[model samples]
Target: MAVPGWLDDTRTSYDTVAVSYADLLRDALAAEPFQRGILALFAELVRAQGPGVVADVGCGPGRITGYLDGLGLDVLGVDLSPGMIGVARRDHPGLRFEVGSMTRLDLADDSLTGLLAWFSLIHVPDDEVPGVLAEFRRVLRPGGVVLLGFHAGDGSRLKTEGYGGHPMHVHVHRRRPERVAAWLEAAGFTVEAELTHRPAPDVEGGFVFAHR
Candidate 1:
């Protein structure tokens, strides 16, 4: 089942965990070349397009959002977890951070020039992904870009570490790149790029770039 609880509690757990193991999380990410490359590419795209504003959906702790901001894009960070939003706000006070769900963003239609969903949809139940994509389509302006990352495989159950010694489990419905590409096309995005790489332990994922 989807997480029906308030996003605040989920974020609180992440905040607690981050406070104790910030360095651990930081060091662990250093091993992720695929992730690094994905972010680099997205930054390059934003620079190339010169988008005025961007939204980082499911922006946990503001890492990707901060990267986008560094590229000079007006970036807004949104996530469902309050703890994550709290951490993002505390860590990057200059940027805007909001507690919001991807399925139902609190923004006007065609308000964004770019959108990034790196590793954000991994936990969303498969049936809900299309709706989330529809929401993405709603907020993005024509010629806007979207960068999405997801684990590569068939649908399955998985667990990953959450905040403060807690375990977060969810149904991970992985899809082939072609299938996702088709879905994005159906949702009004044109495929621009797609790449797959395994750069960290237990992470098998790929990224897709699409333009609205």
Candidate 2:
């Protein structure tokens, strides 16, 4: 989906608020049981792949990126928001982070051993998802894995607003796990395992794990 015009200002605003944003999420996730569950699931998924190099798409503040790093896997955190990248770098100087779009990754073809998109693709329109997945497929080795986390159901843009206290209006695009699995398969990724959970009260989504 074409990003809304306000997103640029949003990024700039986030740059200023980056430190606070990271601190808020860090504390919240550390105490939230649901958040911990999600992190545990992510670790298990990465472990299952028997990793080499991993890229965390939309890795805001490098939260998951740091976790992967602790596991001894080479990880690069990529985000479209430079503000987020800046904060990620400051908080986790030992890790690598880059500013880039998921639709167009700069990495070489088949260069990645694994890819993780944790609720990062929700801002992308439904039509554009295939292209992004194609890029994910292109960067990953023939048998590499792609683990995706997305909001459940056919959620519309009207449902979600800005994230936390961020200055920009955030949009949520939800897709069923099976539908996304089909797209991955069409992009040459074999469907593997899928798990679902509700992280925020009644809110629910599933993580689709596939192999390229």
Candidate 3:
């Protein structure tokens, strides 16, 4: 099948800003106490299921990937942007990073014990989310954990610039937690947890912890 236009634009935009993006968010997780707590909790959940590997889907520059690794889950970082993967490998030479997409992840079924898509689904359109969630389910082992983070609310916007004011052409989407939970259920995932956080007056964060 032919690739979608938005995928190309998103890939190009991230490739254009990969280094600056990496630099901007390198130390970001340290300040995010809630994100850290949940990640640590997630690592525990996966470990409790016995030994297995985890994939950080849409891993960006591998910040969360490294954090999860520190928490003791064997980690693999995958992203839609090669530039992002390059920076990931450069910054964390000890870990594995690959160029891949959640729309169609390049992995075998039931291959992962855990999966993370941190704020990466914000770029995907609403119509595409179910397919992406299905892909998530396909790669995860039965009872495996999946973590998803994204902007919370309704509607979408065209992100024209970001990360040190570099030009970007990607759509940023926001969805309510309930809606996402419904999608997860429809995809044969059991929704385990739902969290919403507000970083600013107008910004709401959505996180869903689910199991396949």
Candidate 4:
């Protein structure tokens, strides 16, 4: 399938700022206790089923991927930006990082034990989210889990600049947690838990844990 225009734009934008983005978020997990807790829970759930691979989709710089690795999960990172993948590989030499898209994963059906879409779906257009979620569903083994983190809101915002004022060309789309749950259900996932929290005073974070 040809890459969607928006996906191409997002890939280009991230590639342009991959270095800066990596530097800025390299140590972010250190301060995020809630996110870490969620990740621990996710790791436990995936490990309960048996030994299998986990794909960290849109794993910029591989921080979460590396973290999951430390938790003893066989995890690989994938992103649309080759530059980001390069940084991820460089930063975590032991783990695998590759250039790939969430919209159409290259893996075989029922291959993954778990998938993490950690705040990465924000760049995807609202209309395309279902297809992406379906792709996530397609790649997972039965009883596999997926964890999604995204901004909670009712609309989209065009991010013009980020990471030390570098120009960006992506629209960050926020969705209600209920709406996202509906999408996951449509994609054949059973919603396990939904969390909405304020990581910062101004930012609302949404997390959904679901099973296939």
Q: Which of the predicted structures, 1 or 3, would earn the higher lDDT when compared with the native?
A: 3
lDDT comparing candidate 4 with the true structure: 0.92
Better of 1 and 3 by TM-score: 3
> Who wins the lDDT comparison?
4
RMSD of candidates 1 onward, in order = 3.0, 2.9, 2.1, 2.2
Candidate 1, residues 1-212, lDDT tens digits: the string is 35544244444445556554443454444577667767777777766776567899988878778867876788999988777787788888999999888989999998988899977787676566788899999998888889998877676665456446665544456767777788798887899987777666866787899989
The TM-score-based order of candidates, best leading, equals: 4, 3, 2, 1
Off by over 4 Å in 4: 1-4
lDDT of each: 0.76, 0.77, 0.91, 0.92
Quote model 3's TM-score.
0.97
Segments of candidate 1 deviating more than 4 angstroms? 1-23, 27-29, 158-164, 200-202
- Judge candidate 1 at residue 140 and give its lDDT: 89
Which residue pairs overlap in candidate 3's backbone? none
- The estimated TM-scores of all candidates read 0.84, 0.84, 0.97, 0.97
Q: How many residue pairs clash in model 4?
A: 0
Q: Can you write out model 2's per-residue Cα lDDT over 1-212, one digit (the tens) per residue?
A: 55555345445555656667687676555665664565566566656667567899989898878876876668999988898998899889999999988878989997888888988877777777888999999999877878898887776664332446545455667788888888888988889867777666868887788888
